[model samples]
Target chain A: MRLIITTMAIIVAIWLIPFVLSDESGLKFGWPYSVFFTLATLFGGFLFYLLRMPPMGPFTSSRRAIGSVVLVFLVSIGIITLLANVSPQFAFEGAATAGATAEERGKAVFNDPKVGCFLCHTVQGAGGTRGPDLTHIATVAANRKPGMSAQDYLKESLENPGAYVVPSFDNIMPPVAKALSPEAFSDLMTYLKALK
Target chain B: MPPDVPLINDRLVLWVVSELHLLFAAFVLGSPIFIVISEILGVRTRDARFERLARETMRIVAISYSLTALFGAAMTFVLVARYQTLSNFIFQRFYPIFGLYATFIVVETILMYAYLYSWDALERRKSLHISIGVALNVVGTLVMFLMNGVGSFMLTPPSSPDRARLWELVNNATWTGLNLHRFIANIAFGGFMVALFAAFMYLTSRKEEDSAFYDWMGYIGNFIGVAALIALPVAGYIYTKEIFAYNATISTLLMADKLAWFFVIQGTMVGLLFLGAGYYMWLSIQRIKGGPRFRTYFRGVFWVALIGLIIWLVPQNFLPSLTTKPAGPIGEVAIPEKAIFLGLMPAKGLAVSAIILVTAFLYLLYRQAIATGTMTWGRIDTKAQLTLTFLPAMAVYTMTFMGAVRESARGEWHIFQFMADKSAESYLTPLGYAATVSGLITVIFFLLVSGIFWLGFKVGH
Candidate 1:
């Protein structure tokens, strides 16, 4: 009983630190994050206590063995719950609230989490290196395929990605058309055309 | 273009069948290596128990070999029918080598059956019988090595595929590392399966002698499993380093961008394996007369493993996937700068190395206990047997999880940079979805393996 009280006291004390600091310093460490850290610290304390126990024998009864498994299972579920709760939720506010202009909205669409364009393609200095950098894509798009205009090429690349494989790149571009609203698709095309 | 199969998730079907194939394949290929060793020991020690163990395990290999072939044939059909375009490309590139692969498989099957059927006939000529066992291992390993060439070629194909010779294509950048990793893993996996079999038999045996023999067998099986497991980290490190050397972009995609969450789960499962192995060792030690004397050493080892596990579970980002933002107000706040260092490679690498070291140390302690004290077989607590059972499940889950991570690391490509998966199923599935599929595969495999164990017992009776 005393050990339980002491553990609770320590957890409460640790949890208060983040809460108080965030309130005073204008930081945004939310309640869920604080709860996660507190639980993690509590788990650490539990491990420390377990380590300090006297040398033990093998579990002599089926009940004891099952109880141990139950304890481990509960702890595992707790960890999974905490992780899931702390994970970021998906949102499209970034694209939805951007300026109404085609290029501006297109840029927003490109960076939107729902669209996930930046996960593979780089523009300027940001995004991933898996696909080609689109920093100068506007200039190169026109010359990529003869008799095809820059807008036409970019449109084809988005709709039918396997139509023309780039010389040095794999044909890995997904059909972004499926992921976009028609308006968002138009905006994304304008954004790509204006990359120069 | 890849052909589409109606009314089914083609990739998921292929994933399940291929994973099942690999599981059975690992057992067949891995068990023979140790079976030969057991046979040799039986001859040298003049111990009939060793001889019985060798024969019993050979029976299991015989049963599992057919499952391996069945799954292999199913996977082949799926590849030919659903993935015709990619299949054609590979077939055209390595037509002659596929013939060699087929020939080796046929030869391996013939040799395996002969070794099993000739156990008694060559009992008088123990040397010749042992020779056949060794010959069987050689052919099984060659079969795996040749297939490794084709698998690794997909990940790290030659730079100039149009002009590269056949040998160069086979000996790609990641081929040797993968071969070494899989070789060690096969031994470890085989050992766990053996332990699982022993645990089941021990639990169900009505006679004291059977229980005692199974108890000893479980120890040996777990010993082999943990021994190989201790060496796996180094092999895995070499494989990862080779991948980085082959392509930095692909490495980034795995470690940082898309597949990082999958790796985090893998680390957790691996930590469970070490914990399970350590706990079983601790329990086994208690059954020895003088084992309690080593309690101090066990405590220290336990602390090392616990700390290592905590460090390994830390993720670089709190986000579950790349595209999402942190929920609620936390979304506006970045992960604190100070906490970032703990999640990175330097700390994680140190933690993994420490975990491996502690496991090895625990095994050494178990060995010392056995050397100094008398082992009371069939006298271990039920919990120890349960732990023995748990190790195999963890091992299977780890295998399936890691396999998923490796295949998913290819992302939208059918063959890395060489060929694209332009099928309807080209995109990367979410980590949660892939994990669910992997879990399903693990459960199905356990059920089938249990059936195989039952059949082997019936046949022996």
Candidate 2:
């Protein structure tokens, strides 16, 4: 009983903390934020649960240990796949989303060498071929058939690299999808979403 | 094309290759199973024949050990030379696991050598040598696990689109399950191959002594085969399920082919073998006379098995594949999902149910064999033993036939077909892997059976 309650309290606490910390946005933060925080926290807790047990013992714990080990091992792989999906510079979003107009924000980040993708990808038949040409990336990948919403594709490209690969190219892209500052990911997503 | 070994005796070449791998897989696959059987037989009879059979089987396995190693090398050569594209894909996509595969084979080879040569000396130190051999063969099975993972990995590379890296690709998701399936499958395959080899030899013997000797060998071989064969379908079911999960499309395509028909045919063979096996168990009761009490038991077991076989033979909707949820970005479109219910082959379900029924009734019917131990050829029955020796030889031939058929089929050489599209013999990979796996399995099965039977014998006394 105590074990179950303590676990629930930890869950409730994870949901409550993000709101308190983010009063600055004062955006109506609610359950969606709670879901992400809760899921992330639970994922972390599961890893902890696995770590405490020696493998090949109690069946449940052992199975979890092995499964967790595989999943933990998958983390880097997941990132590599993310890298395969998108431009590498999506790894960062500027600290300022405070007062800039949306289009100004796109221009600020668009060619900013620090996080701009032009360093690796060519656009408009110019820039670099070190990465895939992205001038039509929004058309080819984001708006690929079967309805990958432009927003989802843009976000995935930044986060998961292996999600889509142009034919003839092996998945060599680096994952910057998760690296996008959440604010930046959302902002960039909003920008890329409009491309289609 | 490098012309066929210029009018070389095709049969001779086939015989050589077939015999060599069968000889090797005999020792490699057979020894552990033989050891178990010899131990049980020895315990039951308190006779030197049982013990002598074990020792002799081990001794021959010892000789076959070198042969098996040599043939294994030939198989590797066969793969690289004959099936390079599929071979390259195997090496590249499955590099990490295949590396472990090489390690296991080296370990198995070394341990088997030690197992064979040291046996005479180890006879005085029986338990330890047997245990050591056990440990070595356990490692042998582990090698099978690594190899199975590599093979199964090709069939089902972990569908984790979310994961990357060579290790992740090799281990993938289905690796463990496939490994489990292969481990068990080999044991069954190994055991049955050995038994059939012995049985064939038993049937062909002319001399009374040879017939009697081969009969004992056959009994041991069949028991091993039946044990392995029975366990195999269960593991195979699980493997099919994993195949289903990894890619329904591939699974669906696979089920549509004649190869899927072969699976059914194999299941029928298994049913017959099961019934035949139960009948044989009945026959073993009257070792003093050629047994006659098993007739009714035979009929009962056969009828039950026939029902299972018939049920198994019933055709189903294979082409109009089951509907499945479309997996990626695609909406409302069906992605190939190997229908989970496909695992419940009505025939298989009936077969297992039949086995249970057979076991119950046959156990009641064959009380004579159960009550009195007559499951062995007498010490004087040298004919049976020698006759049993050659069945493995024929089995190798039969497998070579099936292998040819598998290779010649349509779309069987998907990987090689991709590369060798222009070549005349592009349809070689399926044939090659089948041949390699089958031929290796046969020889190893025999060598192991013979060696273990030899070990169980008390030669000097």
Candidate 3:
């Protein structure tokens, strides 16, 4: 009877987590999930404790040991299914909205998840160190090769990244030109060139 | 594809062969240090059981040494024939040390054989025999250190490769950390392998005396494993910190990007190891006269460990793949904004530390029980013996999974930023694919290990 009452209280607590934690805007925090997960884990642990108590613990008999294994396996599967179905999806905010100007549109393209330029190349101070920082790419591009124009160098870089290996960096950049539409590519170039 | 290896996938073959070589190599290198310690203890205490353990463990190591060489040779051949460019690059840089490595191997081989053969002959000259054993371990360790110099250089090469001195290449950013990590891990791996052998012998032994001896042996083996395991996470942390300090991108790749899920699985496996070890200790108490008195304290320990396991298993983000979009409702909803904090390093680090602490606490409790009460070694329940058997399986999987994570951290490069893998099979395998390959490798390894165990038994008879 005590187990039943305690379990009911726990369920009530879990059910009330969102309501208790959320604001007027319904902007839920991590508190609800944390509390719910902790409550569920504690409740499961309690059940385990009860099952392992004297008189019929898993270690007491061969039958009980095998039964415990099965029970644990089934519980694991159930938990996995529940987590898969109920856990919140990782929210990746959509790409920046298309801007009025070519440079703005190009900035949007660079920030696009599909383009993934921001994943490696730093614009100002934001990005991965795996590749060379491109904060001064507009100025550096013309000087990278003796005769190539800035636009040609940047275009060549997007199309064939391995052509000019940056010093101290591996030639690891993917072909962004293949992934981009022609217009998007032009806008991205414009945005990059305007960086200076 | 290399024309010389048309029938097989060269990379997969090299991966399996090299992993097999490492498995045997770990045992060969690790078993000796403990075996020598066991020998020293036997000499000091005049305990014949310790002497027999040292002799028996040496016999197994002797057998595995040949297997290690065989696999190593096969791996070398595959590398030279199929991955010619990589072979050339590594050889060009580290040719001088290769001779030193080979010389160490030869000396270690001679010492191992002499130590094994001179046991009865040096019964009167026991000090001489022990000296040889110590020398054997030193040479074996030197070989591993040399190999580590080559291996760690691949992942974290000298910053200025063209201008690097020989010492700079040998002592790369991650070299010392990798050496420390592997040194401790080898000890733990070696201990677990001993436990595995003891458990097998205990199960198969018909004589009561043999069962008692094997049971005690299993206990000592597990003791070594647990003691070394306690220090492993700290060593691993140092190694990871070095990787981060050297290259934040590679660290991010491991902790937050493509390889993040691999760590989640690794956490589960490591958590199981701790829990399994604790359970074995709990069951171990049943064999002591005053053991049941301590049973009540287990509940709290168990609960703390469970919480740690849960925390360690939590993912920072639930996204299965960073590159691919999910096909279900999971793709639609965002992780609770604040709950994300619970899955990060602070929580996971605390969780692992807690798990290790609880394991240490349980070991202490077991020790207390043993100190206070009389022990009946072979009288433990079958469940306890089964738990002992389960630990080695978890240890093997953890080792393999970790190896995959470390190797894959290089991603498309053969040597971090220095050499791009322009081969047909350069792309990183997805987590699912890698897991399948790892599982297959693990199964094959266990099968080979079973044969090695069988050979030990055969030699004993």
Among these predictions, the greatest lDDT belongs to: 1
| Shift in Å, residue B38, candidate 1 | 1.6
For model 3, residues B43-116, the per-residue Cα lDDT tens digits are 89999999989988898899888999999999999999998988998887898889898899899999999999
DockQ, every prediction: 0.10, 0.01, 0.09
Ranking by lDDT: 1, 3, 2
Tens digits of lDDT, candidate 2, A28-137: 23443354345444533442342232322111342343333323223322332232222111121222344786645664454433353544566554344557766666
Q: List the residue pairs that clash in candidate 3.
A: A30-B339
Model 3 residue runs over 4 Å out of place are A1-196, B1-8, B321-335, B458-460
For model 2 chain B, the run of ten residues with the poorest summed lDDT: B317-326
For residue B385, model 3's alpha carbon misses the true position, in angstroms, by 1.5
> 2 or 3: which has the higher TM-score?
3
lDDT of 1 by residue, A1-196 (tens): 5556777887787567675664445443445455545665566566556434444444545346445543443344334333433343222121123347898888877865445688788786556667888988999999999999999999999999899977788888889998688998999999999987
| Model 2 lDDT tens row, B151-203 | 44544554442244676655654677666654554454455444544443344
Better of 1 and 3 by lDDT: 1
Worst 10 residues of 3 chain B by lDDT: B325-334
- Pairs in clash, predicted candidate 1: none
